[model samples]
Target: MYELRDKDFIFIFTGPNGAGRKTVAQMSGETLGMKQVISYTTRAPRSAEFNGQDYHFVSRDVFTEAERNNEFIEVIEIDGNRYGVKERDVAQMIEKHGAIYLVLNRFGAEALKKLYGNKAVRIFIYADLKTIVKREEDRGDTPELIQRYTSHYDEEMAYKDQCEHIFENLDLAHTVFDLTKTLDDNYLHRNLVDKD
Candidate 1:
């Protein structure tokens, strides 16, 4: 286990797709004043997703070059589609916002932990498999893509115990409350240390 950081830093929420990670991140971001780091992905965008806003949609070749250059801190392939969080984007977010929030996969979260150690707070969010399938369908994921995702969903959820904290997003309000409480408890204790 790692001790909490001396200063405010990033909070990472990661899990399988449809685990309400992004939704909770956005909600907590509003409450905590943390900015998000938009990730880069080679996957084709959904109909409602906008490039840059949702993800920096890139070609495989371009993404490969960036990966080779170590431009991305973490990269993972999901069913032949590449997704990663760019180091530059994360740096920019941290520079602008004292503390940032991230919605990433297990690979990305682990990478961040290796990079930042205890400076990063890692939270794993998960839900029932049925809820996951329903959410994916509601999001318009193709049947094949959903199949690919569910195929390894258990593997993804297996990493929850590796995280610093885990939350089951069965209820949004409760998850949000618990997340905020975790943050507040840590932040408060850190502040008390500062006072001492």
Candidate 2:
């Protein structure tokens, strides 16, 4: 029903805590000419996140004002913390470049699909739970990682099943190749074949 082409893609990524979604996102950012729009969050920065690099850390007041102005494409409160992705953020790219990319959670993914109508594309990056657990070990994930990942386990797998496309990334090289192949002209048929 959607008549748009591949260039109109907007990525919506979801996962349990340590599924390496960030790594895949960064790869897409670099190779796909897609900018990773920094999220606005009230949560404090973790060791891996540098100020302005991972997110635009803001006080509640700044976020509230922005929300009042109708700035966000999607906004949600999770675990008592607010997070938002500005609508202007995606519109700016689409207005000038004819396409835009958004990396977001499952909830935001569904929301964007609804808002954008035919303009959005969903790509779910997934890994085996055992592989994800090993990835966490390599990244030095603590008990916190285990807890958070466990919490979203069902939702994470569900996103993959429900999304327009899904990629399994247990092997880094294979994942890279798959993602690269994904951007090719032939990729659409591959997705169809996968469904069959």
Candidate 3:
């Protein structure tokens, strides 16, 4: 069992819809014993998604008010829906767990990185367009919505180079293993360098 020791990190997981970013973030959080940060969204919840569990579901008015109050670390509007990460949520998680994970859009991830500097690890999980389309369909997304989301695939792919780590989630087991191994290696390497 590889233990992370006293190392603390904030992982920002970002990918296009149906790329399994949330699922992977949750799995990684469980493996690492870190808390996953829930984002606020004005979009309606899908089947089986609970309020405050999957997302902090809110109305546009509330979301706008939050934005006006400067409560969000970052915010983005996608497909006419608003999504944001609150500063208080991240601060609470950091204070409690010393580590936190966020499933964020590119804008949110960029903002988090700018705010946290070396503490933020950007992980980009990706799959082929065909696989993404299939997964979106499997998740009960309408064809029209999937098409609209797919149109942004190129833009999402462009962010791959911006990430510190990239994982392909086609094989969940391998993906998880790769993430853990990378983290372990980085931690060990950092410790060794610090000792020297």
Candidate 4:
């Protein structure tokens, strides 16, 4: 088993909806002992989502107030809902847990990369259109929601090349295995060079 000795970094997972980004992020975080940084959103939670586990669900007014106070590192609107990551929250998490993971869109990933530079590891997760559609359908997404997600598929895929790592998530186990290995390798390589 490969263990990550160094954890002063940020892992930003960005991908289109229904691509298994969240699952991969959660699994990899668990396997590697990294903390997952939850974001705040104004969107209502889905059937099985918990308040803080899935997201920091908040009202539009509250979110707006935080945004006006410049509390977020990055904020974006998707499907008529606002989502953001607070700067203070990230700092606090990193203070407690050396490394943290975040599930964000391509825009949010880009913003984080700018802020953290090389400390931000940008990873893009993707899947075939058919698989994405099937997964969303299985999750009970409405046709309109599916369409909204698929419409942005091309745009999201285009950003994959910009990421430092790209994973095509087909089989969950295989993808998670490969992801953990890649993360371990990257960590080792970076630490080895730092010692030189």
Each model's lDDT? 0.81, 0.69, 0.83, 0.87
How do the residues 81-190 of candidate 4 rate in per-residue lDDT, one tens digit apiece?
Answer: 99999988888887787788999999899999988888889989999999999998998989987898799999898999999999999999989888888887876232
- lDDT value, residue 163 of candidate 2: 74
Root-mean-square deviation of Cα positions for candidate 3 versus the true structure, in angstroms:
6.0
Query: For model 3, how does the per-residue alpha-carbon lDDT over 45-150 read when each residue is reduced to its tens digit?
Result: 9775899889999999999999999999888998899999988888777777877899887888899888887788999999999999998888888998789878
CA RMSD (A), model 4: 6.0
- Tens digit of lDDT per residue, candidate 1, span 39-148? 99999987777897778899999999999998888888877899998888777777666688888888888889898877787889899889999888998889886787
Q: Write the per-residue lDDT of candidate 2 for residues 114-150, one digit (tens) a residue.
A: 9876567677877777777777777686867666656
Candidate 2: stretches off by over 4 Å: 1-7, 186-196
- Residue 46 shift from truth in candidate 3, angstroms: 2.1
Structure candidate 4, residue pairs in collision? none
Which has the better lDDT: candidate 1, or candidate 3? 3
Residue 123 miss distance in model 4 (angstroms): 0.9
| Steric clash pairs (candidate 1) | none
Winner by lDDT: 4
Better of 3 and 4 by TM-score: 4
